[model samples]
Target chain A: MELSARNSLAGTVKAVKLGEVMAEVIIQVGENEIVAVITRSSAERLKLSVGDRVFAVVKATEVMVAK
Target chain B: MELSARNSLAGTVKAVKLGEVMAEVIIQVGENEIVAVITRSSAERLKLSVGDRVFAVVKATEVMVAK
Candidate 1:
């Protein structure tokens, strides 16, 4: 995924579950885990799997940085 | 949230689960559903719920339009 927001976190694909037309892709970024649900058709094309490198893109305007 | 890619899909919040510091927000966009994870602080401030309108922003470099 091409995100304009500056994201710099990488993780390994921990699991993937195919849904109707989308697939839930889970990745472990450091100590945190995040999920990305993409179309099943896309999953098949990407051939994603566990142990594969993936990214968790996050963009929030209200990123309140607590001091 | 700010995204450079153009995305135009709206949905109603379905569920939310608070994690260590993030909250899993689920939204039903028509027949499809997507998840967005934001800091717990954001969720609380937003006051997200099962009836609020939200947008799902998706940007795939390989957004292949199969003919």
Candidate 2:
């Protein structure tokens, strides 16, 4: 799918921690570990699991730069 | 300041586009250009401009994974 978001880091799902409303997904991208917190419904919709190949997508507007 | 956000890419400000209530910031991180949309007030408070050194920060919850 076409996405306007700029950052899309390819990675493997390392873990998935589901909470009441949110789910924390751990992705291993090279030597870096990226943690993503998403809605439990979306997580369930994606049926996310460990060992899955995915792209961690981030929107440019949601990004903040600190000096 | 300490941040809980996982992604913090160091970059230099390339451009800053100011609007009525929002501002778009373009940061050059290596070969990639990261765009950030922030409130005009925050942008003014930060005194953001071109050629400034900054770190693009993103929280985990704002990140999504696409398979």
Candidate 3:
């Protein structure tokens, strides 16, 4: 599917932890490990595995910084 | 709006560059400035401007890393 976000990083699924309402997915991109939290239903729909390849689409408004 | 992916960052709109089909939005989150490219239509719908508060939503499968 087409996404609006352009920061598509190619990484492998390092780990996944499913919760009742949410799922924590850890992706290893380059030398950096990016973590994402998503709905458990979405995770199940993707059938995410330990070695699955995925893109972390980030679309946010307020990225809080130390001001 | 509620999103399926989590990883919400509270950031400020640092800059916005609109393109024909897409818009580049730079958000300063903590010490890092996360960049997100989204559809111009979406950006316009959100009325994204400098100093706007937003959250970056990321959802991907293959986060490519050096293998």
Candidate 4:
């Protein structure tokens, strides 16, 4: 599916940590690892697992810059 | 200042498009340009302009993933 979010880094799932309500997904994008905190329901719906390929999606508005 | 958000990509401000209440900031990070939409007040507070160095900050909770 097409996404409006600008940044979409393709990576493999390195780890998945499920909390009571939130789920932490660690993705290895080249040398950098991106950490994503999503809803547990979303994680369950996605059925994410280790070694699976995924794209970290972030909306442009959610991004902030520090000088 | 240190941030909890993992992704802090260093870049230079390429352009700033201000709207009535929102602002769009385009940052040149390496060969990729990241677009950020922020509040007009925040943009004014930062006094962001062209060629300024900045870091694109995104929180883990705000990040999503797609298979």
Candidate 5:
């Protein structure tokens, strides 16, 4: 399906850190890896594991950078 | 508007670092901040400036965590 987010990077699951309420999902995209903190229930629903192929989609109204 | 993404974070623009091709945008979410790297054109289109409120959306097939 089409996404409104402008940034969509194809990546592989590198690691998963589950917490009580939040979970940290790490995706390796090329030389860099992006991390996403999500709900623990969401983690369980997806049943994410290592070596999973996933796309990281980020939608932001404004993307700011440090000068 | 409603989004399919499970993670939606409310943040404020802290800084913007523009580069030749890509730009890194930093948003302060409470005490924690999230960073997003997007194309320069996308950054310019949004005209992101400091203190702008934004919502960070992340969509992934699976949200994993380490056991």
Candidate 6:
């Protein structure tokens, strides 16, 4: 079963910063970007690698795409 | 200004389905849900009302959250 916090971004893993037990991920969606804070375990599970094409799904009550 | 699938989801507005102009949003981050397809004038310029609680962003690569 998936948790409530489950949304996704399909793009290139432009960058990755592992910190403590959480990692800061930056996914490039076209010319825009999506930022996600994930746990080390999840990061490893995704086997996320720089330049890798992956989705960063996040379930948060705070999505605001604006102009 | 922002545009690029953007990427966001603060929750509520549990459901919305317009058409053509591309509007079919379902934002419920706490209970697993964040699907976006906007254009119908931003579902009324985010003035969207359906237990309104704005935030539904997406930039467009693909985000993946697993079990």
Best prediction by DockQ:
4
Q: What is the C-alpha lDDT profile of model 2 across A1-67, one tens digit per residue?
A: 6888877878899999999999999998765677899999999999999999998888978898798
In the order shown, the candidates' Cα RMSDs to the true structure are 12.0, 2.8, 7.9, 2.3, 10.1, 9.5
Off by over 4 Å in 1: A1-3, A62-67, B1-67
Off by over 4 Å in 6: A1-7, A59-67, B1-46, B49-67
Q: Give the TM-score of candidate 2.
A: 0.73
Q: Which pairs clash in the backbone of model 1?
A: A21-A40, A22-A40
Error of 4 at A50 (Å): 2.8
Give the chain A TM-score for each candidate.
Answer: 0.75, 0.90, 0.83, 0.89, 0.87, 0.72
Give one digit per residue, the lDDT tens place, for model 4 in A1-67: 6777888778899999999999999998765677999999999999999999998888998899797
What is candidate 1's lDDT per residue for A33-67, written digit by digit as tens?
88776667767777787898866665664345888
lDDT of 3 by residue, A5-62 (tens): 4445566889989999988888765555678777788788888878988875554432
Worst 10 residues of 4 chain B by lDDT: B1-10
Ten residues in a row with the worst lDDT in model 6 chain B?
B58-67
lDDT of 5 by residue, A1-67 (tens): 2333577778998998999978899999999999977777777777877898887767554456789
Model 2: what is its DockQ?
Answer: 0.59
Error of 1 at B62 (Å): 16
True contacts kept of 1: 0.00
State the lDDT of candidate 3 residue by residue for B1-67, as single tens digits. Answer: 5654434556788998999997878876555567877778877888888998776544433222221
- DockQ-wise, the better of 2 and 5 is 2
| lDDT of every model, 2 decimals | 0.71, 0.87, 0.65, 0.88, 0.76, 0.62
Interface DockQ of candidate 6: 0.18
Over 4 Å off in model 5, which ranges? B1-4, B7-67
TM-score for the B chain of model 1: 0.73
DockQ of all predictions against the true structure, Cα-based? 0.04, 0.59, 0.10, 0.66, 0.09, 0.18
lDDT of 1 at B43: 77
lDDT at residue B8 of model 2 (Cα atoms): 79
Interface RMSD after interface superposition, each candidate: 9.8, 2.2, 7.8, 1.8, 7.2, 8.2
Candidate 6 chain A TM-score vs. reference chain A: 0.72
Cα deviation at B63, candidate 1, in Å, is 13
